[model samples]
Target: MGRLTGRQKLGWAVIAVLVFVYALFPVLSIFMTSLKSTSDIRSGTFLPPKVSWENYQQILTAEGGARDLFLPALRNSIGISLIATAIAVVLATLAAYGIARLDFRGKKLILTTALGVSIFPVISIVTPLFNLWRNIGLYDTWPGLIIPYLSLTLPISIWTLAAFFRQIPWELEQAAQVDGATPWQAFRKAIVPLAAPGVFTTALIAFFIAWNDFVYGISLTSTSAARPVPAALAFFTGASYFELPVGAISAASIIVTIPVVVLVVLFQRQIVSGLTQGAVKG
Candidate 1:
């Protein structure tokens, strides 16, 4: 290997430092701010005199059942994310299987139409969906939010899974069929396990999409009983219009963020592969 000049090493180090700061700054800032009291938050220093756990306590046990909504929101977020992701995975895998394996009329057109739906603006269709939900008395409920979330999750799932399926060795499926396994059994016993990485990748994408959505959650769930964390977190504001407690808000944000971070860490390799599943030719 050729030795690098000191100046070249310094240049690369500087670039690495910049990238690290860009990624870590906001996260560090959120955590640091979460530790400060309201007064120190207003003072706005990069560092604080002390760290506190009171904010976490408040969020966990805030106003009787009202403030405790954070727990429910967290639960709802998990529940909703899991249900939506499972449904999306099943539907997307089946659809991808057909597109990747079967011969059908207008296959190109159907695939194009499926991909096209992902491009439509959510805002344009949200109002119509809200009205429809209201008429059917589904508004202000978890289903209202879940159904709309599918609109975002399903298309992306299909696209990614379809790409992944294209990368699979078709000989595996053929050999399983030759061994007398039915199509469904082959899919269940072989394809699904082999596709775990891609499925998890798709599920994470869907989960985060639903977890982080604010517009539909706010629009569809009118009360705290149904509002997810994103909507419920808005209440940490003061009477004079300024936010009530930055620390409490940060604590809440930390609580909400940890699960996604954990999932990502656990599935980091899968995500990396799934993201690049279609870039190579078969």
Candidate 2:
């Protein structure tokens, strides 16, 4: 079509504005709420009445005692997410490459089973997982949380990486192998490097999943010391009375969200490009 008429352009602009506002409303509301006083938060205003830094201050100071307060929980969350992502990236890349490149009997069945397990709801197995952990004395432990986290991160990471691996030309690996590299070396040298963008995207996705998980931490942790920041933040208030500063909660929320945000922000281009690389071609 030729240049849109003024009215048509105006309508399009209004639609774009509407969509943007719709998408940003929750985030904008959360930021605004995070600044509210406890009273105001309970008062349930979408916007804060007065901006006070107290909530943030309390969480940072660990007013109750600094054992596993906001910062430590933040550290724990980071550690868990990063560690899980690291484990996932390594395992998934190898698994994905193997499945995508190698031919074997029931290979389709194996990949399908892996994908099927990933599709199942986490809640279904949580109870048995909890019981198993409890019996083995693994509950409320870091590994207790990490194992379930693998169930969440690994499958999708493997699937996405597998798709990426399928896109790589087989000739590249063959060329490396012909140059005296073993299959593993061929993969390490020729395959992995070129797949860096997709790998980063996979890791970023896994990191966010592990980082954002509340279910795993909530079920596994009974004490603040063992809980991740998100779960620890929950115990800040009580049914009898809201005990802590809302600013602390606000600050905690911000603290918990920041690292994941930064990780995604840094790898945003890679994630986008990798996901979109073959979209048009496909």
Candidate 3:
């Protein structure tokens, strides 16, 4: 391909700037709101009059129950998301390997079903899951949330890992066996190394899915015991019903978003590799 002309470069630069603004606007607005005082928030200005850290401190150490509820909810979110991601990655890895390497009837059907389940509207199942969890005694517990998260995370994990697995050169496994390596040894030494990036990427995606969940978290758990941050944020308030907590909510949102940003920044390369592993023709 020929290099772009100056005019073409300028056009693309403008487009990039617009897209960046569109994506960054919401985050910037939230951060700015977090820096404002309650009176400034009532003024409804996008930029705060002055920087204030009191919103952060208020949520962290309020005399009332904000700190108690927020901290436990944060821990619940972290613990539940980690547990769901671990289980989803393990199960999806094994399932992807089988679907990629082994021949079986109805394989395509299985994949289609998983895809369908993943795309199914979560709201549609809330009523059923609510009743089911309450009946089985999984209600208001970590497993109550974690189990529903699997339904969301597992299908994506399987599809992504399967795509990556297909890109691996099967000849390497044969070569390992030719060198007198056992079947299990060949898989460990030859196959897993190539698949590690995909596994890591799947884990990240799974974690994000479970972490971002709100409907299940809210519908299933009545208290902070199993409620994630997103659901718990709904209960935040100022002094009373008349006093809304815009600043505190914004601060809490910014705090919750930091870990997701960190994870994406630190693992951008592996995420890209896993996503594009099988896209090209060899």
List the candidates' TM-scores in order.
0.90, 0.87, 0.96
Show the lowest summed lDDT stretch of 10 residues, model 1. Answer: 235-244
Pairs with backbone N, CA or C atoms under 3 Å apart (clashes), candidate 1: none
The residue-level lDDT of candidate 1 at 100 comes to: 83
Give the runs in model 3 whose Cα sits over 4 Å from its true position: none
How many clashes would you count in candidate 3?
A: 0
TM-score of 1: 0.90
For every candidate structure, what is the RMSD over all alpha carbons to the true structure, in angstroms? 2.6, 2.9, 1.3
Task: Please tell me which predicted candidate would have the highest TM-score against the true structure.
Answer: 3
Tens digits of per-residue lDDT for model 1, 1-282? 999999999999999999999998998888888788766777758776787666777778757532566777777777877888888888998998888888889978877887788777777887888889889988877787778888888988888888888888989988999999999998888788888888888889988988898878777787765678887787665424565667777888988889888999988988998777755658
Off by over 4 Å in 1: 1-14, 239-243
Mind sharing the TM-score for model 3?
0.96
| Ranking of all predicted structures according to lDDT, beginning with the best and ending with the worst | 3, 1, 2
Q: Higher lDDT: candidate 1 or 2?
A: 1
Cα lDDT of candidate 3 equals: 0.91
lDDT of 2 by residue, 1-282 (tens): 699999999999999999999987866776776787666777767767788655665666645643246676777787887888899999998888888888989888877887898888887888898889999988887788887899889998888888888888999999998889998899888988988988988888888888888877888877654578877777665223545545556667776777767776787889897777523332
lDDT of 2 at 249: 63
Per-residue lDDT tens digits of candidate 3, residues 1-282?
Answer: 999999999999999999999999999999999999887887767888888988988888876656777888999999999999999999998899889888999999989999999999999999999999999999999999999999999999999888888888889999999999998898788998899999999999999999999999889999878999999889888867888888888999999999999999999999898788755434
